[model samples]
Target: MGVLFYGSAEHAIEIDDVALAHLKVVIATKLRRNESFTLSWMHDSGQPLGRSTIWLHPSIELRFAFEEPTPPPLDPAKIQAYANSANTSGGILVPEEHILGSSRGVVLTA
Candidate 1:
């Protein structure tokens, strides 16, 4: 799992590294353009219950930490899809498979 330390207070949000990497790109792009959006993800057993959403803005500090030293290879098509979805009212939805123990590492859809 990866940790996204968000804002000045550094509230940590745990996410899958691969998924976080994809989100990093889209998030950077949006923030660069001064766009704000919410990132929603389903909670795994470790979390309390239900899903969580965070509003991202350029002014806020964000950090991504991965367990693996090296970054994962990202798919352009998938990134584009994520970016497209982010532009919508719902923003970006982190797929269940990306979360730990949600899909047993088998990707059905994102």
Candidate 2:
């Protein structure tokens, strides 16, 4: 299964290719100016099943926020699929909950 990462607050930047590029630009510029901030995410295990970390720059206080206007409502069928595939791993397999989140860290696909 794939793990999606979303910012913890509404309006946080979503880390897509375009946004990541923007992040790089912002980081480079901010670092040049000496700034710091944090970046964090939760794995898609639906529990406290993975590690979360944050990053900071000298001049950028990056607050992890949810770029999505609202988290998509949970789907029961997808939950069943996730439960069925919980034990499998490897390859890019993104469950329904992550269709709109970042596509990085995809390992196992069904």
Candidate 3:
């Protein structure tokens, strides 16, 4: 899995491919419209929340890692089953344990 770093320190906010793609689109759209602000997301662990300030630019790389093998496809039925299980918590879109494996990419505009 890839690690997110802030300068020299590692961050707790690990973004997977699916989330990363969506983020890129959202940011790009906003940037194209000349919008600049902070975007925040709460972590699944619930202990640490994270945010980043986004700006319009052609140079930002939108960095992420795809070094790990892809995870098994998520079955909606299985997702539902585990969602209701006593061991699980509700409200997260994609479960944290598998975030790095199931990410997709988005095309960017110059």
Residue 105 in model 2: lDDT:
40
lDDT of 2 by residue, 1-110 (tens): 21223334333333333233333444444446664444334443433456344444453344423334544444455444433332233211233344233344422222
Best candidate (score: TM-score) = 1
Give me the runs in candidate 3 sitting further than 4 Å from their true place: 1-12, 46-64, 67-110
TM-score of model 3 (CA atoms): 0.36
lDDT (C-alpha, whole model) for all candidates: 0.76, 0.37, 0.37
Whole-structure CA lDDT of model 3: 0.37
Q: Write the per-residue lDDT of candidate 3 for residues 11-45, one digit (tens) a residue.
A: 43455444444444554555466544343333333
- Report the lDDT of model 2 for residue 48: 40
Model 2 lDDT vs. the true structure?
0.37
Number of clashing residue pairs, candidate 2: 25
Ranking by TM-score: 1, 3, 2
- The residue-by-residue lDDT of candidate 1 on 19-61, one tens digit each, is 7788789999999999999988777665567877788888888
